[model samples]
Target: METRIRSEARSYLFVPGNRPERFAKALLAGADAVIVDLEDAVAPHDKDRAREAVLRALPELASVYVRINAADTCWFDEDVGAFAAHPAVQGLVVPKAANTEALAHIDSRSHARLALLPLIESAAAFTALDAICHAPRVERLLFGTVDFQLDTGFGGDGEELSYFRSQMTLASRLANIGSPVDGVTMALDDAGEIFDAARRAQRFGFGGKLCIHPKQIAPTHDAFTPTEADLAWATRVLRAAQGSAGSATVVDGKLIDVPVIERARMILARAR
Candidate 1:
């Protein structure tokens, strides 16, 4: 089986694992993938029930990604074991993944086709980015902004987090994995805020944004999609460069170099 990541995914919606009824609804919510969160979202008392619900829903939720509890926790072992035989899960999202040991453990339980997405949040995880990205079955890393802020005592989310975001991008590219996914936008109903946050992450080289609610999926996808203005500019640049025959040409007072032309081509490609 070929272990692959969903490169075209722009939005990932989270649904609590205990709610099996909402599992189907989440897939229908228009997200590229639905994540059944067993950590943070599920209470300690309901861990067993949530795990049971998630395992049962996997076959029905084709694109579902399960967020299992950390390896240090008791439920972690059981979470991976339950999903091991199912193989219907597209991916497993491990929160606060800081070492290779846990990844190896989960890899031993699951089939070869299951992709691993480590949610890098702790300072220790940051230092161990290379190991985590290179771990067996690791498809990509997901930035946990809210938890990271709490972990690192960082207050601002804009510039303060760029360093971590850049590290995620660089490490993933070097590891030859899919682009890292950015953290979620807390403002659920505000499309403007969600779009801005996702656009910033995309500029930082992220390929996807985490969605806390269904309303955020559309705004997140729109942020990653090329706009009409971008398409128009790319078209103009392509036309000018076509006649220039690779020679340095000026378009809108800017020299159209190889890198500039490449960006234009990317925009046009995304438009298609």
Candidate 2:
């Protein structure tokens, strides 16, 4: 059976694994989830040490996820064996994930119940999107926009990435998983930029965003939250749809059908 994808987290803050000192601070920063990164964030020389530090600190952490090195890396097996079954680990963020075999391998190593958040970062990953989504223990897909750009030679994050973003969202929807998480915005202190980027991601059907800093959390949440006008419209849509008794209805001069009603309910769900 596929793992249940029920996480409603809208902000995932990444803390470098080697920097154990920042673990508590990231958790308390109010991100819906904290990712203890052991992949790109950690330098090659520090890989072993970072894994050691993260494993040692797992008991002190609460419901945290770990971004382990890619399945092809020499360190992958050790990282899996060390933390996959640890109670403190809520999930494992598998970076550069492209196939079901890799996900199955990770699942096999774990003795504890855990979700797998696969990073869709390469063209290869896009080709195998469905396979990755339906892989064992997989729960959510995360768009690694930066790496994807690098891998594909995409020139910019805007139009160049729109189609890719849509593909990720569409694949997740087809797999019945939570909407994929968007990549991080580079701005650390610009709330407006962060909020705009997040809003764009939301429009593209992403449920959350990756954060490199704690400051991005609040703005990310603000972007995902339904506005007053949105809530009111959703309420109106729901009320009107309720009286239709399975028939299409009219609301605000537009036809309200099953899809529109579902959209309204989704807006209200996000608001709540």
Candidate 3:
């Protein structure tokens, strides 16, 4: 059932938990999903109030993903008991998940119906990527590139994170999970830059992107969607394969095999 959300969602707009007023506006913002954040976006002193505000707002929220604090934080355990079992919270985004133990610990407290999204941040997470990806109730992984750069001492923008982003896309596919969502773009009101960043991630195999504001949602969605040319090419490729009786076919100077045909079908499916 979580696949329903993963397939259709190309943009997740985040709203700080403490700001209940913006939550409604965010839900109305046309983002694929609204993530009520209780993690990095909220202040340490405000955790309690934010959690309460989120819980109070959950039933009113149709379908929302709540991002909980790190597993090791003082607020972590309390967060799980408070909302992991709540009927109104459709999903929980677990931050700083660096190992199977962390996931296991959270899983021990979380309900099976609750989709879990683990943020890959720390260097230790890279070492335990396999385990983290397959953990119980895991819907998908999310690349926390900003936090990752801080952890790994990497010093460039999206370019420096290409290899890492590629690994995330590969890992998700290997685990039969949906493509991971890329981190946020800090720049504001620059749709072109946001679209370019999102398109780069999409080309690298990411399925969605995180948005800090509603204004980024539309451009991010635009980036992930296939263009008319792509739809046309996929249509031609599939038609060629069908006519060839699933045998090898040459289209536009490229050989179309089973894998290539399958990719074409997927592109067309997404286009629909």
Best candidate per TM-score, number? 2
**lDDT by residue (tens digit), candidate 2, 47-144:** 99999999889888978999999988899999998888887799999999877877888788775678899998999999999889777677789999
Tell me the RMSD of model 3 versus the true structure: 2.3
TM-score of each: 0.94, 0.94, 0.93
Q: Is candidate 2 or candidate 3 better by lDDT?
A: 2
The lDDT of model 3 is 0.86
**Whole-model lDDT values for every prediction:** 0.87, 0.90, 0.86
Candidate 1: deviation at residue 6, Å?
A: 5.5
Error of 1 at 215 (Å): 0.9
For model 1 the local lDDT of residue 82 reads: 82
State the lDDT of candidate 1 residue by residue for 2-78, as single tens digits. 34454657888999998888888898999988899999999999999999887776678775789999989999989
Query: What is the C-alpha RMSD, rounded to one decimal, of candidate 1?
Result: 2.2
